[model samples]
Target: MATLTHRRIPGRVRDMPSDFPQVPVQDNETSLDGPREAKAFLYKFSQAVEESDWKSFEGLFAEQCWWKDHLTLTFDKRTIQGRQGISSAWQSLAPQRKPRGFSIAGPGIEMVETPPAFVRMTPQMATLDIPFAFSVSRPDCACVGIAKAIPSASSWKIWVLTTSVVSLKEYPFQPLPRAVTSNDLISPEQRGKATPQGLPHFQEALDAVVIGGGCSGLSNLIMLDSIGANVACFDLGSPGEAWLQRYRSVRLHHPNFMIQLPKYPVPADIASTHLNGAELAQYMSRAVQDLKLPLFAGVKVTSNVFDQERRLWTVSLEEVQSGQTSTVQTRNIIISHGFYFNEDCPVIPEGLKDRGKFSGPVQHTTQFSTTDLYEGKRTVIVGSGNSAHDIAKFLGDNAAVQSVTMLQRSPTAVFDFDTFHPFITALYQGNIPVDTADFLFSQLPLGILRDWMGGAIAELVKSSEKLYSKLEAKGYLIDRKPNFIQRVYEDRVRSIYFDAAGAFDLVLRDRIKIAHGTVVGFTENGLIVKDAETEAERILEADGVVLATGYAKTDLPKQWAKSGFLDAESALQIENMGMPAVDVEGEMIGQVTRSGHPQLYFSGYIFSAARSFSRFVAIQIMADINGQAPEHGLP
Candidate 1:
């Protein structure tokens, strides 16, 4: 094993004209042949990186040209400033390397943009896959570099090369013991041969493959696509249902007017205010339709393989409608499959798993839909969140259900929740100190606070009797007052409010009851609630219990083990409190480490480290995957 260190060769410069030549941007199809153009650019780029040919690499950069390595928000806008600046930067920073044969292992390009001819060359850029090693450094430290090509002096040249490292010791393609899911438990014999080699050719080919339809997967698809890479997206639902699957009762805390797909604006009618589940679904469906995005919907990517020789990814997929298995290949794969893939129902305690055998029906919240499930039964809802409030209110109206009991381990602070622009505006203004409104509005994150204020105002207006009565006469609310600051506020204030801890005043007075206690264990009839404050235990019987306990992070994709992409040690290499590791931009650290492979990225709750503890926000997820945050972090 060797460690990379930058070394300078004294008097390495070959005498040439001091007045630097003006570089040109390369056209999208410079060579007329895409493969040849791709290979030629990659070869030259490798030569420059290995031999410390800074001048050659820099000569390819067009004025104000930028390079995104997929992690950095702002691309590398390297300023040549007469060759010396270029040479100095590379010589002092790049890892020492010796040529170990260079080759274009894969040929795939996603055309980002095509600018007309500029600066004696066409201005265009695409991301391509190339595999190489730093021989002078660690042999095991292999990397797949995503390089950019530019035109300079009648030839295409490599402009920027961002390398992500991969090591066999850390990530292997071997199968481990299978973990059980709700469907079934595994038998040792079923493990069979779980190696990349066992899969048929083309059975596993992917650089990064994403397997869920939710925000995480959609955003990842856009990011991987942005880099001009061929990534396959698999999900059991329609392309956007993952974000739209929330119960109809849900609405985005942020107004639809501010939150939208990248480069595309939301529909005018839909953009005016908060978005509901159906509206969100329509938005995603529209994106898919508008982009004509490639997707394998109603199909789930079940497993994958890491092909070492081809340096590609192979995934095993089951098409739900067809009941058939197929595979796809690529060099990198992303498991944007969401965290809540399968509903994570709470684990009934050892004592409680059996309590169900003694009495009434025991069901988890995932199976819950209406109050009718508890109508006639002695309904007991465990947890203090919004669901409890809704469930209590629902069951209160049922004649069959004797009573609805809510078990709370802790109390919550409730607040008013509304969905109009003016209401948010007024509230935001109210929350601000009288003298600091202007300053606060200017400095707030994404102008979210300002939007809040505007929305508060809008709500106040809509709720007024005069306005409501007029709208009632017209059969709908039609008040549309424009505040010049509304758009500005929306642009600046983009935060969404979630009322997980808000008050539930409507349910405060009712036959429904609230109990605060700890569960010591379960008995044959019901649960034993022990009061920590009183040193006493109470036995309560219920027809059913809904455990609203939270969730724990799971491994990115189950097949990473079978494919030997990650071993136990390497799995631990990227962890945040037991979750997978990720950079500030929400890119899984394993995929970004200088030693990790380029064919991988991550999403879902694993990104909690970056976004304060909120994981599934679709807009934030989109921004991170699109490389919005700085490579290292945000200011």
Candidate 2:
């Protein structure tokens, strides 16, 4: 078997150039030669690619452009800008992968079995997105590509190209072996306990080693296990400890049914749309034990050493309580510190004065589990986000509380979540299979979604005029000025506070007071805030302060390098990523950062990341270890 080092994805993700040459506007209805030209272009395009004709490939693209590949030819999600780079990549992989059978989707080319996928136009960008299907020479691979075309002198030229693996012939997504929801119909004794349990200790060496046992880590673990991969997961605390440690009142922002893990899902019988923190933790823990997943709880991954020559990884684990240590070698390492995504670690603002003079309870929202201790005391909650909103509402609903104030520096956008967001109604709630739902939802390109959503968001924003007028009366600074794209993607969490959180409802009724200002510093009695509009200083008296400020970003890569046998260059090759910002190029970052160590994968951030994107990770790793012999790992 050939050494797998040559398959390394670039360590650093190439940031797409911002100064793109704008496309000249044409009539959206007729600019694109509609399906005819698109079919011909793709037909020739597939021929050129499969035959390794670089010249033809280059000629088909515009002078300046970007090609975004998502687990297709590259088997990794990334965007390549410029004709040269894209051509070079396709030229290298096309021959080995043998990507042929191109069609306008309905052409019914030989070996192509996809439906009539068609061309779509974006009036905002004056670009046409043409979806096509193709076959790969590699066993068990089905590929799809979307080409974005702009007007040229005579016809359309490929501006931005996108390719992805729709499915694998060998590893198709299957329903969980057991019922995801718990069955309560049987009596406790009749149900009977399992006769035995799957061992928690993993084999000394494995195909994949997963770090971080939070939601994302567990999701990945479930997927890899379902596919029969020799995998194990390790975390510093018990499984689901991240959620277990949160406030009791903390509930999921989305519905329980829609927020399904890879295999284990929340029981469908729950009455509320929201699942509180405890319920979430129990579901995660039960999934591990019931499935008998190889999850080593209360263990930390202190070091991970990757060997490019042998294409393996030696991971060192440490027991949190006894200081015991062990090592195991594997072909791949997945870093899924779920909490580290965009919402770093808990951040304590610098301005809080800690002198003995200001003697009152101060805590982050994560720490403020209940209002039992400070029932009659005035409370001021810092930050304006999911946690902050929920905390404020929680405090307001308690009649024992004297007053509750929400301190936020930035503007916020609020909307009825189920009504406003399409995901809740369109794909997740329907009768479609979970696998099909997740795949289709994941495949919707951001470039097209942004254009499609901008107008809808604009309409929604206009309709909220009455809502905004009420919020303004309550001293709330609405996100009146929002970038159409950012409102949906990048600035989504910060700006759009879901109505499910209920902070908005309380504020409208004066139950939870709203204060829009910057916390310049903390006062003896409360925080010193500068009004957002006036810049005038004011002091709000509070018996306690809950800093709902976001979690600070953890340096997981640096932490992993602590004890690993990393060469200087290999060390340099490791990188991590959260959600990429939203834009033409930024949206492509949703794929795991493919640069850095070839054997290392850090799938961090976003709720569904590890689950939604884990199949590719499993596929890539399985591909690497297929023909290779299992080496004696570090003892």
Q: Tens digit of lDDT per residue, candidate 1, span 292-333?
A: 444556776666555556655566667676677767765544
lDDT of 2 by residue, 180-233 (tens): 223112122221111112123434467788888777787777776666566778
Using alpha carbons, what is the TM-score of model 2?
A: 0.77
lDDT of 1 at 577: 19
Best by TM-score: 2
How many collisions per candidate?
63, 9
Task: Predict model 2's lDDT versus the native.
Answer: 0.63
How far off is residue 395 in model 1, in Å?
4.9
Which run of 10 residues does model 1 get worst, by summed lDDT? Answer: 1-10
- Candidate 2 positional error at 285, Å: 3.6
